[model samples]
Structure formats: C-alpha cells, structure tokens
Target: MAMARRLVLWGVLAACVAAGAGDWSPGTATFYGGADGSGTMDGACGYGNLYSAGYGVNNAALSQTLFNDGASCGQCYLIMCDTSKSTSCKPGNTITVTATNLCPANYALTNGGWCGPGRPHFDMSQPAWENIGIYQAGVIPVVYQRVQCSRSGGVRFSLAGSKYFLLVNIQNIGGSGSVGAAWVKGTKTGWIQMSRNWGANWQALSGLVGQALSFAVTSTGGQYVHFPDVVPAWWQFGQTFTSNLQFSY
Candidate 1:
C-alpha cells in the first residue's frame, strides 16, 4: 500500500512539471509608444533609453515572472499572434523583440491586478505589435519563446551613479544571450558579486574608484566568461567600456 501511494505521488509530480514546461503558452499583448516615439525611459530593468540607436524603439515590457525581476533584461523572444483567437493576425507571421522593461504591477483588488495575476503577457512597442497583428486589435493573443541574442562587436559596460555605488550596465551581449549572474573585482579587492539592478545593469556598493574593474558573467543558458581588466583604473561614472570577450551559443 505504501509503495503504491509513493508511485502515485511521483506520477502526479511528473505530470505537473511537464505541464509547466510547455513550449508555447497563451497570453495577451498590448502596444506602447506613439508618434512621438517614446515610452517609459526608466524601465524596471534599468535601461535608460529604449529609443536610442543602439537599442532601437522595438522593445517590450514583460510581467514579473517573465521579467524575472530584471534577469530577463536583454533577453530576446520570438512572438507570434494566435490567428485562431484573433482572425486579424497574419498567418505564421512573427516578430522578434528584446526584453527592455517591466510591465507595471496590477493594483486592482480583484482579477489578479495589472498584468492579469502573473499571466504571461507582453507589453510591446507599437512597431513590434504591428509586425504580427493589426494595431486596431489593441490586444491580441500570442505565443512567445526565448531565443539567443545576436549582436556585433564586443560586450560593452556602462558606469552609472558614483564610483562608490558602482552600477554597471552590460550591453551588446551575444549567444545564450541573457545574463544570469555577474561578478566584479577591483585591483585590491577579491571578486565581488554584483546584483542585478534592472535590465542589463548590475551593481556593487563598494569604494573602488581608483582600481581597475574585471568581470565574470554567466548567461541564462549556463555559459560563463571572465573578462580581466575590462575597465581601466581611471574608470569613472557615466563612462562606457568595451571588452573583447563574449559567450558561445
């Protein structure tokens, strides 16, 4: 009797895991940005300007889980409209977008708050939404999946705030794509782990203004790279540095 009960529980657990691992999920999408071509500049993930030439205006804001509270920053996704639900959708058409911001929390007392109670959703830019569905639809059902980020040149790091605060933004990442973990070290101190501040930005609260900065990054796909002396000792706030290292897909 005991063995049978254990087996049943195991089977149930396996089924639940399988269901959660579905390749495609159903959700809703809405668009932001207008003729002025501006959306929220201070994305939860710390990206300051989404309309810049580097990031472009085509980006998205995802719900909390999808946003992973900033871990999903710089992540790429391929989203397609569900024609069965919205007839206006172009058959088999899809749009690729980079995760740049976080959708605001639903504050309603009922119906699970802002983004629909932790539901999978995308708050896309108007240009991105237009790629797969008619803008007139306003909201459309869709499916999306993570894909590797592709970019040219090396990875770049930008310093924000003061050197004592040590906020760094990692950009132009390539391969397994999104950053999962980052560590920083100065000339005198040992490796210091940095916390994700938002989007591609990470922060370490320490005083290392005069020491060079080196970094090690781990991607969401589990790959890792160590960049030594990526930032010179003279690095200062509001400055950007580039490293020749990147991850393999």
Candidate 2:
C-alpha cells in the first residue's frame, strides 16, 4: 500500500516533470533520507493543508509523514542546490543544488539541522544534527492558542471560576501568539490551567504554576507548554494570562 502511494506520488511528480514544471510552483518539495522515503514530511501528521492567500476552514488531517534517514537521529538538508548533475554526497559532504528557482513564500522547507541558501538547484541530505525524532521538521498547521484558565475553586482568600477558552491563531513558523502572561502582583495564592492546542488539552506547567513562565508571547518561541491561570476575586487579575503554544511537524 505504501509502495503504491509512493508510486502514485512519483507518477504525479513525473507528470509535472513532463510538463517541465515538476519543480514549478511548489518546486520539487523534496526529502532525501529516512527508510526509503517513508518519513520525509513537510507538513503535519494530521493537518497538512495548503490554502490560497485568503481561504479559510483548511483543517484536514494528514495521512502520512515525511522522514529522512530512519537509522539516524538527526540529519541536515541542503536544498536549492546547483542542479548541476547526479552526485553522491556523503553525510559530512555539503551537497549543492544547481537549480535556479527563487524560493516562493509557500515554497518553504525545513530540516532538523541548519540549512543554507543563495545557490540554486539543490536538494541533498547530510548528517549533522542535534535532536533525534522522526516526527520533527515540517510546515504543520501551527496551532497557537490559549486554553484552560482557571482559579482555585475554594482556597484561602481565593475564588474559583471555569470560563476558559483556547485562543486560536493560525500562523506559520516563528510567529507570535495573541496573548502574554506574567506573575500577577499577588499570585502566590492560587492555581490555573492553560496551554496552546499542542494536543487539545491543558497540561500543568512547571514552577509558579499561576505566575511562572508568564511573559508576553512576542513569538511562538518556546515549548507549547500549558500554564494555568487564576481569577481569584472580582478585582483579581492574574498577570500571567499571557501564554501560548506553537505546533510544528
């Protein structure tokens, strides 16, 4: 079945090749490693979608994943190379693409390790990495949000309420969320629950449960961890209501 899918994808790509646009538009979205191209993904596991500049409601679950080098933990990708010709670049070798195509905004790519650019016609994979996870690196349905804000149900000098929301922001890599968080002047007296839609549930965060890691999310720059909020009293405002998460494939 998987082979059939690969053949189908290859066939579609080949047709594009026939039209002299195999690498047109999307421009050869490539993955060169992994167990026989079983895990070379450029999108999310459940939500890999493409939308026009102004289209909405694009939430489709993905059927497969992209991987490169199954036995290896981490690998580096060098794309937009020289398109010069066939080459057998090794793990430590720097493969160059000779293709001369400008990178369109939607024509994006990412790898576990750092990649380079400026040259054209390139698509090679090498080994130089940090983290080792097959499910890493891809243009996913970045789910930035705010979820689970609460306060002590009944604690000393604290009141509780359960009016929560999962702030949703549909953004791409390195984008910021719509909120921020901080340790309210008086937050050593309660607890809350919050998280971006990393998995659709608010899991407790570490430290200063209510006021920890509270900072304005200028960018989706950290782990999509959840932090609970508190609404102790009518006038009680938890300064830490400003947290968010970023989902990457």
lDDT of 2 by residue, 123-161 (tens): 222121111111343221111111111211211111112
* Superposed model 2: Cα runs more than 4 Å off: 1-48, 52-169, 173-193, 199-216, 220-249
> What tens digits encode model 1's per-residue C-alpha lDDT throughout 1-249?
445434543454345347673255667777876634486455766666654314566678888768786788878887777765666565556677888888876733245744654678888888888887787887778867776677666777888867478888887677765788999999999999998876678889898799998999998889888999999998788888878887775
lDDT of every model, 2 decimals = 0.74, 0.23
When summed lDDT is taken over every stretch of 10 residues in candidate 2, the lowest stretch is: 66-75
Clashing residue pairs found in predicted model 1: 45-198, 45-199, 106-113, 106-114
Considering every candidate listed, which one attains the maximal TM-score?
A: 1
Candidate 1: misplaced stretches above 4 Å?
A: 1-22, 35-37, 51-54, 107-114
